[model samples]
Target: MSSLVKNIIRFILFIFFQHFVLDKISLHQMITPYVYFLFIIWLPFKMPRTWLMFIAFLLGFTLDSFRHQPGFHAAACVLIAYIKPFLVNMLIPQEGADTNYQEPSIKSMGGPLPYFIFIAVLCLLHNAWLFFLEAWQFGNIWYFLIKTILSTAISILLIFITELVFNRKQKFRTNTI
Candidate 1:
């Protein structure tokens, strides 16, 4: 299947799962797991930055619609999307980066550490911005930090499990002309 088709399917599934399943699960007031961001994280490595931010905005806006929040998710999504390429470059490095990496899966990233760091950092940024926006008053910094940390941890776990379940190990190509 083409990357376009696969991404489209993933977009639909992520939205559906987030809205119908994850959003409904009230594990705690401060620990809502957000796996929808996984859709953005799973995008092809070379996708255009503009397209990445646009898609992230759309995904977040869609989730905001479900949650009845105005642009909160959109803001966080765009922020993380903006930082994703930088994180990828910093963690993976130019020499280690592969053009054929269709997605940021553990196998494609060559191991779990880089992939985990990539996802964990993005998740932290997303959750921190999200909770901060939700609590714009800045009433309690400690509470805000705790919420961000807990949510990020849960989100990271969900992302890792999803990658393990759905990501296939592809053989890396060595012959680069």
Candidate 2:
């Protein structure tokens, strides 16, 4: 149907999948692949920054409420939300950007390389903030680094897989009565 409808459904599905499936999978204490942030990352490019941040807050707060954490995800989500626009501008040059593309994706990003870079940087920042906040101490740098890196890698992998599986090439149709 419409893009708004699709995104609304996507938001629900991402929350359900993340909280039920992905969160339950514990490959290790240090590596939990969080693919939920993909929802925020995939939001329409034209969305206002304030609304983006608010939505990110809600997503993260919902997760925090589920997991019994105190704003770790919320903080990380806001961080990425705040930085996303700048990242988009930096990664996708105006001359090269496709105006028809509504959000960040491999196709919209022009290729796997730029998309990968975009995802990688955001995922890294997200994981780093999340793990650091969870730890709340710099007493163990290695612990933070290992956990952040592993989790970011797995999250990125899952995000890419999700994108490949679910990403659709949209078309606009005109109707005449």
Candidate 3:
């Protein structure tokens, strides 16, 4: 029920789903849905940057171990983790940065707009970096761009569906003076 316990469970589940299920799905070899990054996005808003990066690295490394892709995933994860705070600040704004916001969700981050933007930017960045690294020596910019765009789109859709299905809106109480 606690944040720590919930996050631990999430970490495990995301990794399992990613490696065992999503990883096995080869959709035309271009649309690899990466819902694993959802774990990083779902982390508590107030979590320390160091811990966020560490967890992201761990998650990516674990995935790398399964997929045997060197450190591409790890690097992408760390990059996204590093920029997450800035993105959150920019998207949520000062007045909306409420302390009660536990994590980045449709309800917690306010409404669907901010939340959608937040997820889209992060997913795009992650997919771009990942596909760029994967296609580093290929020298085909068009290929890299196409793969990145397509993968990012699929990942974003999967993340949205997962959030809608699994995440529940937390009810908040307002005190009147």
The predictions' CA RMSDs to the true structure, in order, are: 1.7, 3.4, 2.1
lDDT ranking, best first: 3, 2, 1
Local accuracy by lDDT, each model: 0.85, 0.86, 0.86
lDDT of 3 by residue, 1-177 (tens): 888998899899999999999988899767888999999998887799999999999989999998887698999999999999998888785464546567778876778999899999999999999989978977789889989899988998998899778856564533332
List the candidates' TM-scores in order. Answer: 0.92, 0.91, 0.92
List model 1 lDDT by residue over 51-123, tens digit each: 9999999999988888786799999999999999898887774475557565677767767888889998999
Query: Which sections of candidate 1 miss by over 4 Å?
Result: 93-96, 169-175
After superposing candidate 3, which stretches have Cα over 4 Å from the reference? Answer: 93-96, 171-177
Instruction: Indicate the TM-score of model 1.
Output: 0.92
Give the residue spans of candidate 2 off by over 4 A: 94-98, 137-139, 171-177
Lowest summed-lDDT stretch of 10 residues in model 2? 168-177
Candidate 1: the clashing residue pairs are none
Residues 32-56, candidate 2: write the lDDT tens digits.
8899999999998879999999999
Q: Candidate 3: lDDT over CA atoms?
A: 0.86
